[model samples]
Target: MKTIDLRSDTVTLPAQSMMDAIASAQLGDDVFQEDPTTNELESLAADTMGKEAALLVPSGTMANLVAVLSHCERGSEVILGDQAHTFMYEAGGISAFGGIHSRQLPNQRDGTLKLEDVESAIRQDNVHFPPTRLICLENTHNRCFGMPLTVGYTKSVAQLAGDNGIAVHVDGARIFNAAAALKINVKELTGSVDSVSFCLSKGLSAPVGSLVCGSAEFIAQARRNRKALGGGMRQAGIIAAAGIEALKTMVDRISDDHRNAKILADGIAEIDGLSIDIDTVKTNIVYFSLKRLEIAGEVLVNRMSELGIHFFELSPHTYRLVTHADVDENDMDEALKVFKKVMADL
Candidate 1:
């Protein structure tokens, strides 16, 4: 039986074109800025995000960390949502390595921090306060039902940050998905921010890589931070080539993943024991919970896995499924059937 893994977009394997690019790519030491393929990818990434320059890093976490390290001095603070990936998932790298402090505000259901809340969270000029140096936002926010932060909201945050003499950075790991779902140019989502980091691995289907885009000065600083963090890769064009291929080919089809997610969410909503807000099926992520308290999420997950359909049990009752390049509409339909059978049997 074929296994349908809906755990995350990060699970996607690189396409054949990406593999071919990797095999044929020219290689040089990226640490010395001599890798032509890596340089080309960085240039392409910056142009795509409408930024003056870009730096390639190993992963999205490093991209965010490097961005923060470059933007603020030690002991400065950054404002972000409580549910943000950087706050919740990055394992305190910012504070551990950079001595940066974080002030987390409540996240709206649509994955935005209220402007008033953000403004209030900014520290007053006091000897005891950590100066707020940056504001962070997420595009296609993962924990909030994959909500895409709108362009207008981003501009508002950027404006507020600018007025307060603070910088803005976006943890845009799945930003391409956000652009596709919103039916807008990706640049519009990123134009106002001081820096934005996006992943080529997730949704883009590259083997590995993330790019941080910003002003040339910011990227030069970020590049130094990357080296300090031991992220400087030699002969990295072998992998960067795949990233170049992914950007060229994989962006436009993300809408198909969004469509599959809606279909999957609609199917889950129709199941007797499963519950979901079909309206929140915005991009490729579908989140649902069990209305039948008697059935544990792990039991359902394990049963579905036994049937070759795999997803995540986020909690005892809550579950998540992500549609990616590897999973298709037929896989979604089959998974729904298995989900129904498992719930009924349990």
Candidate 2:
């Protein structure tokens, strides 16, 4: 049986066209800024995000870390959601490597931090508190049911940070999904922020790479930080070529993944022992709980694995499923059938 992998969009492989582009990629050392394909990808990424420039990094973690270090001084502070990927998932690189402090505020279910909460978190100029240097926001927040932060909310946070002389950096790993879901241009969400980093490896379907976009000066600093972290790649246009293809052709089709996720969420909700809020199935990520079922999440995972279905266990009872380029509506239907059979057996 063919496995229907719903664990993450990162599992997606590049299309054949991307492989062709990679095979024909123009090569030069990216560390020396001489690769034409890498330059094109960076330029395209900057144009997409409406930034002055962009730097391609090895992964989203390095992209965010570079942006953080570029914007903040050592021992400074960053304000972000408690559940944000930067704070919860990035292995504390900013604090570990940059000596920067992170102050996390609650992330509302809709994946927004309250404006009042952000205002209160900004530190005063007194020596008693670590100086607040930057504010970070995650688009299509990974852990918050993949909820997309609205342009209005992002602008508000940017305005708040601007007035306080603090920079705003968006961890936009799934930003294209956010743009597709909101039916708005990606620039509308990224316009006011100081920097935004988006992943090509996720739903964009590139094999490996993420771009950090910002003003030219900001990106210059980010490039240095990326090198310091050992993220520099020589002749990296092989992957950058695939990224160029992903950005050009794969953006609009993300809506199909969103549709499949909704279908999956609705189907799972109908099962007697499974539960999910179909409304939260806004983008490609679906989160459901095995609340009514008596079986443990681990047991369900093993059983599902035996049936050629796989997803991430978010907790002892909650699980996450993501639709991507490789999985289609038919695959979703098959996965749902497997889920129903598994629940019935339990």
Candidate 3:
């Protein structure tokens, strides 16, 4: 049986074209700024996101951390959603390494911090409070059913931050997915932010790497932060080659992943013991819950795994599945069959 892996888009393999590009790529030391292929990738990334320049980093975590470090000084505070990947998943690198403080606001069901709430959270210029230096937003919010934040909402946040002299950084790991879902240019989503970090590994199908886009001066600062964090790479063109291919070939097809997610969501809704808010199936992520209280989420997940299907159990009752470049419509159908059978037997 073909094992259906739906855990996350991060599981996707690079395309054959990416491999070809890597094999023939020109190589040089990236730390010295002499790698031609890596330079090409950075220029392409900046152009794609409508930014002045871009810097390559090893992973999404490092990209966010570098962006935060470049924008804020020690003892400065950044406002972000409580459920943000930087806060919830990135191991608190910003606070630990940069001594920057975080002020987390509530993320709504649509994955936006209310304007009023954000305004209230900004610290006053008092001696006791850390000065607010930055605001962070996540596009295609992971925990919020992978919903894409609207262009209007992003501009509103940017305006708020600008008025307060705070820089805005977007953890845009799945930003292309957001653009495809919204039927808008990716630049429209990123134009207002001061800096944005996007992943090449997820959905884009690059083996490894992420890029941080911003003004040239900001990128120069971020490059220094990357080196300080031990993120600088030598002969990184081999990785950049694949990232170039992913950018050139993979972005247009993200809508297919979104379609497959809807298929999976609709199929799960038909199962007697499974439930999902079908309306929230906006991007490549599908989140559902086990309505049968007798069966725990782990039990169902284990049973499905044994049956050649795999996904994530987010809680005792909630589960998450993501569609990506590797998993096709047939895989969705097969996974849904397994889900139905497993739910019935349990």
Query: How displaced is residue 243 in candidate 3, in Å?
Result: 0.4
State each candidate's clash count: 0, 0, 0
The sequence of per-residue lDDT tens digits that candidate 2 reaches over residues 31-92 is 99999999999999999999999999999999999999999999899999999999988899
> Candidate 3, TM-score vs. the true structure?
0.99
Q: Highest lDDT: which candidate?
A: 3
Runs in model 2 with CA error above 4 Å?
none
Per-residue lDDT value at 276 in model 1: 93
Which residue pairs overlap in candidate 2's backbone? none
| Shift of residue 113 alpha carbon in model 2, Å | 0.5
lDDT of 1 by residue, 1-346 (tens): 9899999999999999999999999999999999999999999999999999999999999999999999999999999999999999998999999999999999999999999999999999998999999999999999999999999999999999999999999999999999998999999999999999999998999989999999999999999999999999999999899999999999999999999999899998899988899888999999999888876568888899999998898777999999999999999899888888988888
Lowest summed lDDT window (length 10), candidate 2: 291-300
Q: Each model's TM-score, in the order given?
A: 0.99, 0.99, 0.99
TM-score quality measure for candidate 2: 0.99
Colliding residue pairs in candidate 1: none
